[model samples]
Target: MRPSSDRQAPGGGPRDFAAAEWTKLRSLRSTWALLALGTVLTVLVSLLFCALIGPEFRRADSAQRRALDPVGLTFTGLQFGQVPLVILAVMAVGNEYGTGMIRTSLAAIPRRGALLTAKLAVLGATGAVWGLLTGAVALTAGSTVLGASVPLHTDAVRALAGAGAYTGLLAVLAAALTFMVRRSLTALGVLLPFLFVVSGALAATPQLRSLARLLPDRAGLRLTQVHQDAGDLSPAAGGGVLLLWAAVAATGSYVALRRQDC
Candidate 1:
């Protein structure tokens, strides 16, 4: 008889693992709820901003008008909306550990690499779809409210794609960080404050703003803008910077999963 250690997971391959991950994610009510809330907040707040800012925009001084990017305005909610997605992603991974299911998962697969990859792929795919939908709807709503047409220029298309990528990467980052932290609340507690407050505040200071742009949220959000700030990187470059962060986090996740006692 073959040794038990030599046995393969019942249906474990790229396709099966991906399918299993998708099923696990979709089966969770919290996942649906968080995504739904994220969509609503992203679209609704952007629409509201359109209404509130339209008149103010018209009355603003030339300098303020020059600084505005209508396309970017459509997705203003992302600054706030990303929180729920972060929490959802963290919870997804963290809950498995919190609930003592990681042991069963590791027992079932025995391949941490494959399991982590599956989880990330599913989370990324879901976030990308959600981001695309939110971007499209927010832009449409903003244009309608502001009485202007947002053209499908190259920059606009890039913004939409970048938004999707940002959403996907952010989720992946959350999941990775959760694995490294080994606790959902601890991960959430760290991520929520840093991404929301610290990063923004750091980016707002002229002296330190250049340094802050290197952060994932700051760099990632730059893709949504057609115009770059004085010291900002090109949209493509900014996206690349954000990608680097996610990649680093993912590497850490895999390493931690391997080294840590599950």
Candidate 2:
């Protein structure tokens, strides 16, 4: 009988979890499409809005332009940009569950908590890098179109950084929810209403005004605006709120993943 060689299987390894995630991310057509859409939407809308408002401001007297927060003008597209961010984040996590790949993933990475953590780390890093480039491009392009000087104040820079952080953190949050809920469509159902309709309504309600400012979407929005409303939280405070949500969501996902079987 011939001796069988034992080196390693063609597929299995200690790094399989990360490799699997990388494959899933790259192979999924939606991932690339969504990312492209997010980038284009953010940059284009900012340019368009700036183009519309810039000429009007230029036509106005110096006094009128002085009163405007030029810094805020550059990020006007942030409001719309967030929609695609949420979608990308949601699909990243939710798709795994939807396709029943999480089970296979968990089986391979039996240390389920670690697997989720790795996923969050990978997505967060990707988000931060892409977001920084996108924000910088949008800000620069929008400023040129608007004919306004870019604000370099500490608070302004911090707020711009916060915008990138918010995108990455939200991506992790979306992933976590998928682990806990195991239902992509349902998670989106919950996420959408909470982000859009409910948050907007809450922000408008005087009775719920305090809580509304602390909500994830509301808080994240505040960070991108240079002019703080009377009731608006500071950009730093908004960052904290977003971070809190990311932490909570991540913890919840880890707990569920570890305790439950794939």
**Candidate models: Cα lDDT each:** 0.85, 0.75
Instruction: List model 2 lDDT by residue over 1-262, tens digit each.
Output: 6665656436554366666676777787877777778788888988998898987878878767755656666676766676666677667777777777777777777677668867887677667666777777887888788887665676567657876887777777777777788777777888888887888899788999999888887786566666666777887788788889989999898888778755
1-262: candidate 1 lDDT, tens digit per residue: 7566645646558778878878888998989999889989998888888888888777777677546777788888887788888888898899889999888878866889988998888888888888988888888787678655654777678888888998999899999999999899999888988898889889788899888999899888877777767788888888899899999999999999999787
Which residues of candidate 2, in runs, are more than 4 Å off? Answer: 1-20, 59-67, 150-156
List clash counts for every candidate, in order. Answer: 0, 0
Q: Which regions in candidate 1 have their CA more than 4 angstroms from the true location?
A: 1-11, 56-66
Enumerate residue pairs that collide in model 2.
none
TM-score of 1: 0.91
Worst 10 residues of 1 by lDDT: 2-11
